[model samples]
Target: MKVIHLHQEEKKIIEEAVVQNRQAQHKLYVKYAPKMLSVCRQYIKDLQQAEDVMITAFMKVFVNLKYFEHKGSFEGWIRKIMIHECISYLRVKKEMKFVEDEEFTHEMHNNIESQFSVEAIQFLIDALPDGYKMVFNLYVIEGYKHHEIAEMLGISPGTSKSQLSRAREVLQTQINSLNKFNHGTI
Candidate 1:
């Protein structure tokens, strides 16, 4: 594992928390909760459900603090925990399924060159089917490789790639329509 040098104050807080210091743990929670919650929200649509997942993730973080070897950024470690929690929650709720690559229709070829806002793009992503949305977010937004996504979702790498392709096709179609509508060309 690569050694990561954290700020002295951050290192001190982590050391204290590792010893089960409640105050230090609370400090860590306060510092990371919002960002972790946002990560949870990306996978969970319901706000309350996302909050619950965040809490569960934090609990795991505290319980497993001793296992953290400071090999990477502390925040990255926390983010991984939160992401795992979200994946667990999604697996239980969605029972994610994947179709074989051969089953997918030919990929749609649409050029989407719109000046849509980030909010609009996010809305379109949220509108995707649950499986597609999860795969899309993991691969596109989170920068995870298809094989990594497959491992996380318990699907084959081909399934992950196909889902991502479908997601982009859908997004492109939506963006094109929006662009046309906005330009009065619809």
Candidate 2:
């Protein structure tokens, strides 16, 4: 499955699939499942729930493929669907709570100085509380605005900003502790 080769012709295949080509549709699913699963996992936090969300999102994408105008990147469009589906799953779970800290600010400048390895940072992100993780992923990783995150997660923009601030603060603290512990060992 050379996606790069199909990138140019995917619109035609998708259009055909929209009309009636089960094989083309299946090919599209196979092509997108892994990436979509990753997207789903960021929001749901449970492997099974993520898989279920990916399946539901793919179904919606295929069913609604006719609405696609090829005006933008197909991958981006599908990614949006996965994001929406994950948010919908989260909403149904009613886990959209936000941390409130009036004094919290995005002042974790030390963590961004390239001192922490990618694996270390990723581990810290994975360990974040659910609310923080969701906000961080939406705002930082996915390039969404705090207002968009607020609407997606049903929280206020202040809450989204607060969660991101708290997440960064936690990551900074963890990194500092890790550095201190490592230094003491040396």
What are the TM-scores, per candidate, against the unseen true structure? 0.87, 0.84
In model 1, what lDDT does residue 69 have? 89
In model 1, what is the error at residue 35, expressed in angstroms? 1.3
Residue-wise C-alpha lDDT for candidate 1, range 1-186, written one tens digit per residue: 233344777888999999999999999999999989888887787889999999999999999998888787889999989988988988888645567673565556555556878667778988887888889889777899988998888888888878988888888878778878888997
Q: Rate the local accuracy (lDDT) of all candidates.
A: 0.84, 0.83
Evaluated at residue 115, the lDDT of candidate 2 is 69
Worst 10 residues of 2 by lDDT: 106-115
Candidate 1 error regions (>4 Å): 1-6, 102-114
Lowest lDDT sum, 10 consecutive residues, model 1, at: 1-10
What is candidate 2's TM-score against the reference? 0.84
Residue 65 lDDT (model 2):
93
